[model samples]
Target: MFYDSYLYLVDGSYLPTVAPTGLKTDLGCWKYHFGAIEGMRQNGWTLWTVILIRLVAEEFNFKLSIMGQGDNQMLLIEFTETLPEEVTVNQVNQFISALEEKLSYIGPPLKIEETWISKDYLLYGKFPIKNRVALTTSWKKNCRMFRCCNEDFPTIETSLSSLAANLYAAVASDNVTQPIFFLSISDGHNQQFSLFLVIYQ
Candidate 1:
């Protein structure tokens, strides 16, 4: 009589196992690589992103991290964690998207512009002998062109670096101590809401 078995190393412990012939460790596995965390800390992910990842992982019992690509000098995040109850995969994906969007907006202030329906145009007769009609009356018409304002504008910044820049400007210069512009898009108003950051120097 003989016994056929196998062994698996988990957390530095070699445990005997008698399971299927082919075992896929990638699926439904708790992969905890300290090196991955260190790599993310040194390179790709910010402190906020790391904190957010930890928070999300703790809240949802998910394991995710930024892994380095072999010899490519690039890093990527591998998300392989089950979400909480009633949460869809898209919601989990939105976490990554939000991080990326925030990172992209970190460099400079974002300018928001309002698009106005300026005028309408009408076409009459055949294509070969068509005449263009420009409507100037205060009546309903089709949209032809959009007019964007260039005078007053708004800007948005959400990172600490931007805050530092604003603070530095207030201390270093007097001309930059005026109203800082910002904007927000509101669905209720169906327009761009201009916001001003008044720094009293």
Candidate 2:
């Protein structure tokens, strides 16, 4: 759907090519331009509602933002839109539950916390292992797990790079006909997440 600043008012079924007149003269209109995702359900193309849940707070004129912190590590999302009225834990959980329902394939582990400042909430989330190249019916045992963290140098990037190279090396050594894969989770900083590299021969 194509729209100017009045995106909230546009009908979802309207095509982008049929943009109304004066659309080009509107200020801050370009920011509202959205493209349709190919696989989304019918009549459900809203960006915040369908994909980016973090920005949903904007619809209510509240503050919702994310940042990477803690020694250049860890992703933190803060929601601080509620004022005058108290924001309950149940409300936060309901919001998260809605997101989880939309993103169920993202795994089951999620952490949520509320700050003492009232109405401010923090959510810690992670992306699960995606089966990009193969079907992941179940996780196998005996997989090697590596943890490398807390370094004065660029440990996270180097570790991840080395992990990828090592997987290729292992595949070559074992003469495996199938593809070998590894999982990498980084908050883009000091903390190192669990890395599991498996070679299926």
The top-ranked prediction according to lDDT is 2
Question: What is candidate 2's TM-score against the reference?
Answer: 0.22
Candidate 1 lDDT, 64-122, residue by residue in tens = 54433321211222344454434545545555455445545662111213111111222
The true-versus-predicted C-alpha distance at residue 155 of model 1, in Å, is: 64
Report the lDDT tens digits of candidate 2 across residue range 8-70.
Answer: 324554333335663443333344557643544333423323334553333433344444332
How does each model score on lDDT? Answer: 0.33, 0.39
Candidate 2 residue-wise lDDT at 100: 52
lDDT of 1 at 125: 19
Cα displacement (Å) at residue 136, model 2: 42
